[model samples]
Target: MNTLNNHENTNILDLPNEMLFAIMNKLSKINVLYSLVDVNRQFDQLIIDSFYIHDLDLTRKSLSGDISPIDKQTLDRIICGKILPRINDKVNKLTVEPLSIERIFHAVDYAQLYSLSLVNFSQEILLRHIIDNAVIHRLMTEQITCLNIQVSDKIRSDFSVKNHSNILSLILFIRENLNDLTFSHWFIGLGLTFFMYKLSSTSCVSSTLTKLSIFVNTFDDCLFLLDRRLESLSTLIINIVQIFDTSANIDNTKLPQLKCFSLASYQRTCSYDSRIVPLLRRMPNIEELTLFLSVIRMESTYIDGIHLHDEILIHVPRLDKLLFSITTILYNINAKIELPSNDDIQRGFIEKEIYQADSYVINDPSK
Candidate 1:
């Protein structure tokens, strides 16, 4: 029998160099620099090698999209004081909010910057940076290849009336060469979803945007986008409130290049129909799929948890992996999942597994 007290305690700092570096990779670089830097010459040298200092998030953020106020003293020490000259050349991805966007540009020339993240920015700042000032335009067109943007104080109830032309223009601008894009907001309304699909209405489809994470408000929004500029989308993540029934058969449309899809539903109190069946029919080539959905088992009508796998396993032509996270409202119970094999499309063999949990990550064979 193994004893609980038999283990030895090892100090993190005393670990091997490789182990130390691995641990450092998991931690926030901002915290690492603030806490561990300048403590010793060895530490400084290790952190300065473009790995820890390459990606920087100058602004503080959280899931709610509220940005922490910038401290002038801290900014002075980080930018004008010591950081610019030390890691300017090494920095490749720099995230800045509207307040410090101009200041950071003036302080350093991140010649190597390939990715840029704009976080917690107001609509006014977005317009100024991209339109009035043209600072963001120049950086985006010339240097950046990947962009992640989170709008500020996203709508909780209402959106103030404003011209959305600038917002549309900025999104179109990024479509030029941006390979990966994440545009998210904390809004609980359908405005953001409408805006996302509106971008696809343009004459030109994005040939470069391969991966995207965005909100989908309705069945129309989903079908409209899947039929438009998102044709080249390979990896997609959808945050949808609900999928409704359509009078017309939607099987004609397809996400031809899509290989990986992740879906999450927000309307928790209501149980949905097997709407994903038609969706999988269109995505015939999907290799991996992940679902984060809430199951509402009301007393009047109870949906068998097996419904999750019943359709997908029988419909989708090819699927290699599946990840699921399901939440229940009335009662909590294990789900019986039916997973298809890697070659199930050809071999025609279906496998059944009883999974007892709220989440699971299942993989294929040939390991």
Candidate 2:
């Protein structure tokens, strides 16, 4: 009787605004908007506030990397209903699965949206977005600054060499307006060679592009962008593998604005440093650099019996921060990364943003 009376006496609406926002932050914003929007006048007004409705995730994903879209009934109700109209203007980032992306875009216009995260889209849909479509024209109205594409397993499995070439062409098309680009979970297929060929042949570039993170067929594929003279590029995280049979040579390309760079090797190679030193030499303005290798034997002598740090600093004159990491490739196709602590940290480098499990400390870029 006392508990029931206490609950009745202290209503949730009586809480302070800050306390209410703090409680709501723990729950999904999507669920919050669905549940509390029509509760009362005060609730409706609060849901549309900039603090609660800036970034909207229209779909949810599981830990094992599966995208679970919202149910169609609820989705249709939300779209035909008053929710989107109420807060559409406040949305800055919209993350949506492909199934509902078209409908969501047509439902309402986001005046302030700048970031679009496209998840699990098929090759056909990806191509559609690139062509002369309503989505492209509508999207161009806003100054799009970022594009995050997560390729679905089905798409990767079905994409042939020609299909993947189309995907690369789409990337080049959309990259003109994008400042930051990120792609997740790429499947290695023979088709990538043709895609790389297209990228290397193209001179089309983005002056606004500043950051890029992608997986490529070979080190030459990664260097294709640098050779094109992407002048505004500042940060890059590339998964690179050097194919021994392929002709890999560093051009006279220079990234004058590049400040941070990270490299991930997909295969085990005995000559990691020998191949990498020339690549670093091209980035004259790099202040922070990270190298992720599949295997590293530190006890062995480096080139010309020189210390690795001295050789790297000699090549990249502006490099003051670096992360040197090694990862183990397992039989199950899973990777186990172990960052050894021997030289870079012993010389007084500190750990910055960790990529995988264990990470090597790096020199400070601010210095």
Candidate 3:
């Protein structure tokens, strides 16, 4: 019996550090590292040496208020010591939940990390901590690459002018970073000042951005901002809450590098500003275009003076594919209309021979 037990212990010790590291990486929570530290001296050393502890989720559950004091202390030590020291170089993704700006700043300041995701954050939280924190601003300049800022309607309802200024400051800071940015929010009540401020701030670093998405409540605000001359931008996605015409002052020639564009709008009050067709006229390099209309009325005009079909033929001559999602109109003044099938648009465009014969595939195969 003694000989058999000795052989089993020897086998366990023979396991390679790589295998041990893999096992630790599979843990769902970083705190689990503490548990493994107590398993054996070998595990403790292995966990300390592994660098794959880069994905961090700081939701409330992860930082449970019920955590024992000792555990909290231990976590603080690990974060301030090992984690923070390697933060700027090792961490690639980070998700933070709704918390005080102070706590958020504390986590971000020490991390000096990139790829930040903010969830359930309001304008107040952003203004208080992130905008006010100089250290956070400095860290963003050096390390951040991907950023996601999402705000709900309720949050917008509570936004004030001061809050708008705070947001502008944050945008200015981000523009300096010139990273991939995603802004998801309803800018319904916010005045034109917000758009002007944002555009002026972002224009400073438009040359560095590769991906940009704006979810706006009104196309008017977006069009006003897009009117400014952009230096560099490759991918663009716009989800508008209301239909509005693009500004005539827009300099389309500046968007020569654009490769992808998507516009989604609702149909009930759906109306396309004729300026869009002309704007599309300038994006000759766009390979993929998706236009989605939510509602349709029976009497609604199918072809406005914009000549969407004609513009596509002239400007985007090398277009690969066009996607159209439109609702059916049951009646215009009581006249019934059938919804056009998506495939119908595809077939119609193909029959017209509008797409380039050897253009790049619309749907990325690798994705």
lDDT string for model 3 (276-332, tens) is 555677777888887776443344434311335664646776667676554433234
Task: Give the number of colliding residue pairs in candidate 1.
Answer: 0
Of the two candidates 1 and 2, the one with more favorable TM-score, higher being better, is 2
lDDT of each: 0.64, 0.65, 0.55
Which residue ranges in model 1 land beyond 4 Å of their true spot? 1-28, 31-40, 61-66, 154-169, 188-200, 246-251, 269-274, 295-310, 326-367
Q: Write the per-residue lDDT of candidate 1 for residues 161-192, one digit (tens) a residue.
A: 23243464466555487777776554434345
What is the C-alpha local distance difference test score of candidate 3? 0.55
Instruction: Kindly report which residue pairs in candidate 2 clash with one another.
Output: none
**Cα displacement (Å) at residue 59, model 2:** 0.6
**What TM-score would you give candidate 2 relative to the actual structure?**
0.76
Q: Highest lDDT among the candidates is held by which one? A: 2
Question: For each candidate, what TM-score against the reference?
Answer: 0.73, 0.76, 0.64
Query: 53, model 1: CA deviation in Å?
Result: 1.4
Using TM-score, rank the candidates from best to worst: 2, 1, 3
